[model samples]
Target: MKNKIIAEKSGVIDVVIIGAGAAGLSAALFLVRARRSTIIFDAGSKRISSSKNIHELLGFENKSPEEFHNLGEKEIVKYGGDIRKEKVLKIEAISNNLFAVQSTNSFVTAKTVVIATGLIDVIPEIPGLKEGWGKDIHVCPCFTGYELHNKKVVVFGLQDRIGQLSKFLTAWTNNVTVVTNQPFAPTWIKKLSAVDVQVINSEVASVIRSNGKLKGVITSDGQKISCDAIFVSTSMQASSNLASTLCKVDEFGFAETDAVGQTSRPGLWVIGNANDPIGHLAHAIASGTKVGPMVTDYLLEYSLADLIK
Candidate 1:
């Protein structure tokens, strides 16, 4: 299929999933298998697309993000779920038990809604770093460690977790350098110096590049060192605007949900990166897997009770 972008509005689906990432697809797969009318509206912004391979996922190692979504979509459709390539611009609760989701092309009303939209990585402001991003410069070592085997790598830390990340990256390469934009690193970093990962304390001014590839890092003092790649560890902001508009968010800006992923709103639910703290693919899928059945059962039971009354 060439990935159709249809603007035609279908009637209200039973459940409207706001994203098509791992979480949304997993939930759709479970819900459709239970014979519920489900529709997935994908904004098409999966962070894993830049990843060369997905790691630590059970039964799926070294698979690209495109491949993962392709298989997932096929499975979901086979179970009678509808997938739409549309972005959800706004969502609001029309009644006590209904939601109205608005998109660029169409609008949908659903008895239940799942906000699985993920987070966005705010990369560091460094020249040439953006160009090499998702290629030589990586964010998640779990996804790119194998590809970085035996290469000269640099890990940039915006927080205190760099020492731990430096230790993790050392598993893939011998020549690892941890850079903190300060005069001295923490005591733990100095203790780990025996692992052969050099800790550089300098304010990074820019990323040096040659021939459209990453060469090294340029410090504020006008010194440069040649390296093969760089990995940046920084905080991310959740892409939860639609969720926040409809319901209350937690202190961390994530959609607040109960044990079963039910939000403060009765018919609104949140899963995946919109609610998770770590935002890993496996964790997102697990959240969806658990929430899908719970929401389905809730809707079915409520419908039955209404019929009996």
Candidate 2:
């Protein structure tokens, strides 16, 4: 299918941004402020929506993930940037600094593209884990660990190296139990035990809930390990598959980008979790804010050259 080119009475759109999470919306805000035409495509289902409290976002530290996303949409629209809830199926480079982006219903030709699709978390296969995630089980200790401070916590991960990761939560709670499903745990067992951490040598079968709240985790052998919170050592992968099809990725599973979010491919840039798997909310906004001006300058030059012709 041919990619549809969106044009307005003034001229063609300056940039096309994928994903409306922090990065995408921040970029749009900057671009529109510069009077550059921009469009944002967001598939929704952003992982942050699962988070009850969006951590470390300055000023709105107490805002929920859903509320933050809504505010971002409003900010983008207020500045005259078009925000669409559509999934980008594919992006094709047509010519110099020009490409075609296709979605389920529509497509658009853009002078430049910014990818901020973020990441998808790989949750473990324990029964009830999916349902309890973000509420009882968490990947980031800082997100919910504070709430469970001084409470019983069970830390579970597939690797033995998770022993070290579990130790960090000691600041939040002293009652830390490291559950390594592997029969033979890692050599770091001595260091962990020295700190009074309990090492459980069993695989978790499911998350047990009592009256809609987290109770504990049940082991494969039917042992119930009581805990108030479960901290998961996330084995994260970037949401960079689409970007990888266009450019190379780093060893860390993130797309290689410059200091300002420009990718290896000209006219393409990556931001947020798609560029770095461990990027927090602040990093996403910073990267997008930096890239927005650069894209605006590039489009300005392109438009001036067009006028000369």
Candidate 3:
């Protein structure tokens, strides 16, 4: 079907979506299919781009993040959704519940705004850890643990979380070890012991890599522990501050939203990792799908009010 682009007298678009990740593209697909004039601002380099292959997401399993996003963008464009490769610098609430979206080189007005800006994983400052990120070093094993099944796995970082993560890794591998000097409560230690996970009380000074591959880790006490994969319970923060500017955000700058991605500010929505830091690819896709109808209904009511006026 040909796109029924909504043309407003004031040149306002039906929706302006920021961040062309899975959630943003998914939302744009729905809006364009619903005959809304949608524009997506894509600031390149999504959080998941670091992963060589995406897992757990059905159909796109083992596909590169770049490939998934490329296909998603194509589908949106096929539906007459305008996708721009520009970073949205700021968003202002203009009169009449419209929004002014400002990017690096373009500006536009929109009836509603959707922020799909994902979160950033704060990796521990261990030497060489960043070099092996998304490959040998990861924040969570839920998505990639199967690949490391029966292989030696190491867990570290965050005094409160390492114990639990170490224990969880046992489900995928019996050779689970946690490296941390920080003291854990007796219960946590007992839990790790019950799971047959090893605990090493030492600070990881650096990762041991050879020829661009992770070999193991070197502790501050000069202890070398070998592992096929390492999981760090790192902190996370929202990638963009735009949501914080327009809605109620937590300390990490994640927008506080309703179940359907509606922020405290009407006409503004936050989904994906911008709202739920721990949301995976599937969750992001589901979030975008859930918010599409809500946004469409909001536009319908808005158009009716304008007609009455």
Go through the candidates in order and give each one's C-alpha lDDT: 0.80, 0.80, 0.89
Which residues of candidate 1, in runs, are more than 4 Å off?
A: 1-12, 183-186
Most accurate candidate by TM-score? 3
Q: List model 2 lDDT by residue over 196-290, tens digit each.
A: 78888887888998777888999888889998888887677776467877888865467888888888887788988887676788888888899
Per-residue lDDT over 1-309 for candidate 3, one digit per residue giving the tens place of the 0 to 100 score: 365465577799999999899899889989989989999998898998778999999999999998999999989988888889999999999899999999998999999999998988988788899988898898777888899988988888888778878887888888998988888898987888898888888988999999988899899999999988889999989999998778899999988889989999989999988898878999999999998999999999998997998
- Writing each residue's lDDT as its tens digit, candidate 1 over 1-309 gives 332222226455678888999889988888888777788999786877776777878878877879889999998887777788988898878864778888878788888898888887778878887787788888877777887897998887565777778888888999888777654456766656778888777767889877987889888778787788888887777776887777788655688788667888877888987787576889889988998888788788757877998
Candidate 2 vs. true structure, TM-score: 0.89
Ranked candidates, highest lDDT first:
3, 2, 1
Q: TM-scores for all candidates?
A: 0.89, 0.89, 0.96
State in Å the error of residue 35, model 3: 0.8
